[model samples]
Target: MSRAFRIQVSEGVQRIVHVEDGVQGTIDVLPILAPERMAELLATELEKRGYTRTDQDGELVLVKVGEGNVTVEVNVRTGTVTVSIAEEVQVNVSTTASGTAENIEDARKQAEDRAMRQLEAAVVPLQEAARREATARLEAELAEVRPELDAVVNAATAEALVEKARELGDIESIEGSAEDGNLTIKVRV
Candidate 1:
């Protein structure tokens, strides 16, 4: 048997960019925070501190990343992040049937296999939790740098706006959109 888990990090570039720009720009540019890059950075950071990156089917599992022993699981397509600590689980099996000793032994093995499967299932959620923790930490750090990013973007936009105003006579209108922390400003002619 097999099991799967995911923790989604929905495209947050929209919100983050908006927050940075302070609602004074009209370009809909997506910030570059690709899921793969994020995963790789996280894994590398963890590995630097003696953490292991494991390949589990299609997920990137971080066995440890940073000051603590934490596991993170990432879903490539869906961009889900899960964080949790992994713990070993024991499986027990018992059989009561009047048959060949070999048959009973086989039954015990089957039971043990079932128990092992159960253990894996239980461990998956812990990985999901770890992913969440890693993601949270990343977001918090990103937030601090947002204003600086916004200033750079805004300065360039201002330069472009000056050039446009010179060419287009005068700005007729301005509009802003703020969603999920993303900011966009549009100049109307």
Candidate 2:
């Protein structure tokens, strides 16, 4: 006589997922002086705007950490700015299945396979949710940071322009607002 056996198996999957997004752009500061001098001026301006100078990878970079864990890094020498945010998500899923077979081992294998397949199916939705959450966070941070970043770059450019005008000739007067995005300098060479 052959006897059938019932077997049950459970499987679990756990993952720590990292989601990150960022924007990188160049600050359009005209090369009004030597590269080193321009970088120095930019660094000074950045410091005035609450960015702290720090060494990154043996290179000087200006860094600011803002609300929502957003980080802004400015490579003074290269006029490059990177704004980024990262989030960590934990995903845990488990499944259980039962099978009956003539042999206990065969039943256990069938149940295990079923459990594994259920876990595999759950993984995609979990990953998709994590990604959506990350993207939403990035969008919110960008909304808050965009105007401030624009103002900082504009002010830096205005300062550089004023310095360049001085080097070129005598500046009669300066006018307009950097915040307004209009700056005029009257220099007589």
Candidate 3:
């Protein structure tokens, strides 16, 4: 573990800090300030503003007690942290009608709200699947089966090839597709 250093925001007051991990005695100064300290200060400021941290149902606990745009998320399982930098987006969907103006405007507004809700519902699942796939790709890689392939190739005959295929696991069946001629091996893997 490395020593934690307090970043000087002002003369003596520190706004951000970082954990210095490297040599036994030397400090590793981050070019960028510590994200955790920013999160803490933001959380404190939010507390001052009368907002409180609350459980975000079952997805993840989001700490939204910040005064401004910064939002922090602390995962209960792994104790992992995430920060969200947000911006407000204004959407306007307006329509002009000749007769029955009130009904038309009300219908349009309702339709717009429903569309936004539907979009959110669909996008959330897609985003979750994408995140899962990305994480899996980053963390897992296919093992090289070349050596296993070589063992199977060195088999004396067709029957031995089928046995080798079965030993590799995940193989449903191995069949000689062609009558003779080098045996067109069909591998179900």
Higher TM-score: candidate 1 or 2? 2
Q: Which should have the higher lDDT, number 1 or number 2? A: 2
For each candidate, what is the lDDT? 0.40, 0.83, 0.36
Worst 10 residues of 1 by lDDT: 12-21
Off by over 4 Å in 1: 1-102, 161-189
Indicate which candidate wins on TM-score.
2
- 1 or 3: which has the higher TM-score? 1
lDDT per residue, candidate 2, 124-185, as tens digits? 78978887777777678778666776777677778888988999999999999789899989
Candidate 2 segments exceeding 4 Å error: 10-13, 168-172, 186-189
- Evaluate residue 49 in candidate 3 and report its C-alpha lDDT on the 0 to 100 scale: 37
Cα lDDT tens digits for candidate 3, 56-125:
6553333532333334454322334444333322222322222222355555555555555554555545
Question: For model 1, what is the alpha-carbon lDDT of residue 159?
Answer: 39
RMSD of each: 18.4, 2.8, 27.9
Q: List the residue pairs that clash in candidate 2.
A: none
| lDDT tens digits, residue span 44-95, model 1 | 4435445466677857654433223334343322334444333332323222
